[model samples]
Target: MIENIHFIAVALLIALGIYTLIFKRNLIKIAMGISILASGINLFLISLGYRAQGIAPIFTNAAIAASEVQAKMVLPAPQALTLTSIVISLAVTALMLSFAIIIYQKTGSLDATKSRRLKG
Candidate 1:
């Protein structure tokens, strides 16, 4: 029962992001939606690799052996991927925000309709 909450939250983030992307015309809001959507995907990846009461794969003490870790430790791949995704998301969000700033400067409005009119 408790484990389902993570998945539910992930769904909510993605749905809300899509809603914002579709309904909102503001450039900043759309960028935010993209960020939220990326976060949802990262969460989904993490949930896929989750294990109940699982420990790290690393061996800290001298007594622990590799065989024990193989059976009980959670996979580390998802965590590493999540970290990489976070860095990529940050860069993309920064780029999007910079573009939004440029658009706002040229059109004096963040609305998609105004930007489209300015383009043609």
Candidate 2:
């Protein structure tokens, strides 16, 4: 079970985020849920690139054999993707929160059901 701790954490984070997104009425809560979901995705991506006794992809040592370096070095692609994801999620979260703030200013409420678009 310990071997899959990261997977377990990812599942929990996703579940909580989904629950919040579906059941919460507040716009801020919804934004938090999205942020949590993004965090879980980032964790999953990082975990995917993990290796036991792994080293960075960078190789500064000239004496090490190429085969040994290849065997020990972790893949860089997932880390790069995760970094990009972080930047994107940060922007998305900022946008969501900013929109929420503007909506609250106009409506004086953060409840989604009370928003302009939802009322029929």
Candidate 3:
């Protein structure tokens, strides 16, 4: 089913991100993996609120009564949470990249192992 495909894709993203985080030595790659992981979580949250032929939970002047709309409206909580997560992810990504830049400047390499050796 199409719904199952969405979840499968989300799982793939999460798996790939974790693999990258664990295996990649580059700081940038690790940051990208974190970003990808965040995206998967965001997608999963949004998908949880999906409904077939569901209407928006807005107060538009459509040909439907408020009571009827209540039954058909997609859950708004997931959507709001997704938006908040997006903003938080952006901040985290920015902070991570900035730290990567600083690390590269101090250690002259982006490899995680090399950077650790430089710390002592």
The global C-alpha lDDT for each of the candidates, from Candidate 1 onward, is: 0.90, 0.92, 0.91
Candidate 1 on 1-120: residue-level lDDT in tens?
776999998999999999999999999999999999999999999998898878877667724567777667889999999999999999999999999999888879999866786453
Q: Order the candidates by lDDT, highest first — what do you get?
A: 2, 3, 1
Off by over 4 Å in 1: 60-65, 118-120
Clash pairs (backbone) in predicted model 2: none
Better of 2 and 3 by lDDT: 2
Among the numbered candidates, top TM-score falls to: 2
Residue lDDT tens for model 2, 1-120: 998999999999999999999999999999999999999999999999999988877777645679888788889999999999999999999999999999989989998987858555
* lDDT over C-alpha atoms for residue 79 of model 1: 93
Candidate 3 residue-wise lDDT, 1-120, digit = tens: 875888998999999999999999999999999999999999999989998888887777756687788777888999999999999999999999999999989888999987786453
What clash count does candidate 1 reach? 0
Global fold similarity of model 1 (TM-score): 0.89
Error of 2 at 112 (Å): 0.6
Candidate 3 at residue 57, lDDT?
76
